[model samples]
Structure formats: C-alpha cells, structure tokens
Target: MPSTDDLKLRIEAAIPGSSAAVTDLTGTGDHFRATVVAPEFAELSRIEQHRRVYAVFGADIGGPIHALSLVTKAEA
Candidate 1:
C-alpha cells in the first residue's frame, strides 16, 4: 500500500507543473482521493486529465492501491 505522500510525489513528478493532494480516504493506505491541479489539464477533457493521473500509477491501480478517486482541475 502506497502512502498519501508517495502518491502525491508520483503525481507531481509525472505531470510537470502540477500539484496533487492525496488523501487516504479509508485510512488503510489503499483507498485514496486525489485532487490534482495541473497546467497540462488546461486543454484536456476531464477523461483525459484522469487518464494522465492514472497513467502515473500504471499497474499499481487496482493492485496495491485498491481504489483512487480523482478530481482534476486545470491550473488558473
């Protein structure tokens, strides 16, 4: 199970100029909710933005990480 800070770092690293706030929604370190704000999301659709963040986790999603709820926003 990945920690919230680990998830945050991975997201920020994967998406340049992005900020991620990761919460352990279930307190188990496996369920998480991430609020990601990125300049890269400015032109992308919501699905696309989610895809970008999900890509950072790759096979980890649904594996070590049980569930990840996401809220993505384009940076103003």
Candidate 2:
C-alpha cells in the first residue's frame, strides 16, 4: 500500500510544476483522494486531466491502490 505522501510526491514528480495533496480515504491505505493542480492541465479536458493522473499509477490503481478519487485543477 502506498502512503499519502508517497502518492503526492509521485503525482508532483510525474507532472512538472504541479502540486498534489493526497489523503487516505480509508484507514487501510488502499483508498485515496487527491487534489492536483498543474499547469499541464490548463489545456486539457476534465477526462484527459484525470487520465494523465491515472496514468501515473498504471496497474497500481487496481492492485495495491484500491481506489483513488481525484480532483484536478489547472494552475491559474
């Protein structure tokens, strides 16, 4: 299971000039919610922004990380 800080760092690292806040939705560490703000998202649609974030995790979305809820925003 990935830690919240780990997820945050991964998201930030994967998307340059991005900030991410990750929280474990459940105590189990498998469920998470993340809010990511990035300049890269500025021109992307909501689904595409989400897809970019999801791509960072790959198979981990269904494996070690059970669920991840995302709130993404373009940097203003």
Which ten residues in a row are the worst by lDDT in model 2? 67-76
The global Cα lDDT (0 to 1) of model 1 is 0.94
Cα displacement (Å) at residue 42, model 1: 0.7
**Model 2, range 1-76, lDDT digits (tens) per residue?**
6999999999989999999999899889999999999998999999999999999999999999999999999964
Candidate 1 residue pairs in clash (backbone atoms < 3 Å): none
After superposition, which runs of candidate 2 have C-alpha atoms over 4 Å from their true positions? none
TM-score of each: 0.96, 0.96
**How accurate locally is residue 34 in candidate 2, as Cα lDDT from 0 to 100?**
97
Local accuracy by lDDT, each model:
0.94, 0.94
